[model samples]
Target: MAIKAKNLSFSYRKKKVLENLNFEIKDGEFIAILGPNGAGKTTLLKCILGLLKVEGEILVFGKDPSTCKKILEMISYVPQKSTLSTDLPITVIDVLRMNSKELNEEIIEDFELCDKMKTLFRELSGGFQQRVLIARALMKNPKMILLDEPFNGVDVLSQEKITKILEKVNATVLAVVHNINPIIHAVDRVMLLNRELIAFGKPNDVFTKENLFKAYKAEIPVVICEEGIIHPLYGDQHG
Candidate 1:
């Protein structure tokens, strides 16, 4: 297993953010966490990254993240794009070099960032900045990756590119996404949360209207296309 959480709960300023969360992610599986704002989507990622203290247990590869700090090196985390500053006068290559002295040419090429190496990080579009951050996160060659709101501010083309790249990664992935349209078909499972685990299973099975209403506390449109893909029309931060 890549991650296991049992009765996991977290509180901020004495109010619970996450409560009694229990789930397991298999090796190499891609999981998408969906919920409204203040639903503890990002907090869960922090807990997995061992950035926050919480009740119960969260284990990475069967090791406690809080105790065994070494396991943290095996996991890479990328926060929401809005929280990252792009006004710095650093080049794409310079930003990447911060993580490792030896660069992976294949990754640079695969992300289609070869031509932008010399470009200033601040000059790139929001899509490109997100791509650069994700590429930088992979420099450590981690076994697992955590991404929070990766698609925020990203254009459709960049979203497609990022989704395609994620489909090919060998490591386990857990992404907190505001909209599931970009990767609804690629992810192995979908987790719905609203201070609790509302549903955890395959997208088709877990994305029922009833579950969506329960998690969002409102009726949400759930659509199934001709290809049998489930699409939740109400996947924004409005709540």
Candidate 2:
């Protein structure tokens, strides 16, 4: 298994976040986590990455993420694009060179970032910057990749390109996305979370009207496409 969370629960001070969550991710599976803001989606990812102290057990590749240093080496992470400073003076190449001794030319070409290699990180568009971050994560040659809202802010064309790049990645991937429309065809499974596991299965099975209503606490419309079923207007659930 790529990851296994058993009876997981977490709280910040007195506020409860996750509760009795349990799930398993298989090897090389691309899973998309969908939830409204403050549903503990990012917290779940952090727990898997061993960034936070949690109440239950989480195993990455059959090893504890928090205690095993080797597990950290097998993972790559791309955080939300908004978390990055666009005004930084560093170049794309500089970002890639930060942790890696040698650059992976293939990744640069694959992400279509060859031309922007010398451009300042802040000068590129949001989509290009995201690609740069993904490229940097690839430098580690990790077995698993975690992306937090990769398509949150970008043009339609950039979204398509980013989806394609993720589709071809040869690793276990768990990404947090606000909506499942763009990546409907790319991900193999869907995990709907709202401080708990609402549903988890293939996109066709889990993206149902009933499941979405439970997670979002509202009547969410589901569109049946040739690829699969998707929630067109998914976003922060506010009520």
Candidate 3:
């Protein structure tokens, strides 16, 4: 399940979102799409899903996703948990059922939806909704799971649980994440994007002081801690 992009460029009514992007994810790799807001991270995912028209080549398993329905099934995308995109009156459990009929009440309950299943999706908190979405995504038994901000608005314990489950799952993960500290160890590589490829490699190797400074456009000091791991100092922002 190799995912590769070559000279990819995209736009919205002439406003460019991504440009000349190039990268590849080998089979069974956990690659994180790291970037700030409006960085074309989500648009890149949509292009792969064929929801957006774009320029250049995007190959999933060596096939163009734009014209192929089979590639769509090979990848399952989970939107931001709190996005109020769907219509109302739908229960959290109902959304799961929409994805898979094999997902019965019993299956939903096992995923810890017994109590929250009856609640309206719009009314339920963000964390609960994310859990339901994650549960629904698992039903596909997909080879690659593309998650957009999976940790956003999720509580710490729940985030830990979800990350652990994803780590243990059979699926390879390609996620757009904001807070990289928690799951940095879990991810095999990182792709820093801002309309282009800034850096892509193992977390420690790619999140260098120079690269982070360049991508973030802020002066962040680096400190060498125990085990020789480098940590960025937030300076006035944190202290």
Relative to the true structure, how large is the alpha-carbon lDDT of every model? 0.89, 0.85, 0.77
Per-residue alpha-carbon lDDT of candidate 1 for residues 188-225, written as tens digits (9 for 90 to 100) = 99999999999999998888989988888888887888
- List ranges where model 2 is wrong by over 4 Å: 227-231, 234-239
Evaluate residue 150 in candidate 3 and report its C-alpha lDDT on the 0 to 100 scale.
85
Clashes of 3: 0
Q: For every candidate structure, what is the RMSD over all alpha carbons to the true structure, in angstroms?
A: 1.1, 1.7, 3.1
Which of the predicted structures, 2 or 3, would earn the higher lDDT when compared with the native?
Answer: 2
lDDT of 3 by residue, 1-239 (tens): 47888999998888889999888888888888877677788998898787777799888888888888788777888987556575578987678876676765544654578888678887866677787888888777788888998878888876776777678667778888876765766788888877778899977776687787777777667766675655555522421
Put down candidate 2 lDDT per residue, 1-239, tens digits, no spaces: 89999999889997889999999999999999988888899999899998888888989999888888778888998888777776879988999886587998998888888898888999888878888888898888889999998886677888898888788888999989886777888889999999999999988788777888888888876666665555546453331
Q: What does candidate 3 score on TM?
A: 0.88
Candidate with better TM-score, 2 vs 3: 2
TM-score between model 2 and native: 0.94
Q: Candidate 3 — what's its lDDT?
A: 0.77
TM-score of candidate 1 relative to the true fold: 0.97
Clashes of each: 0, 0, 0
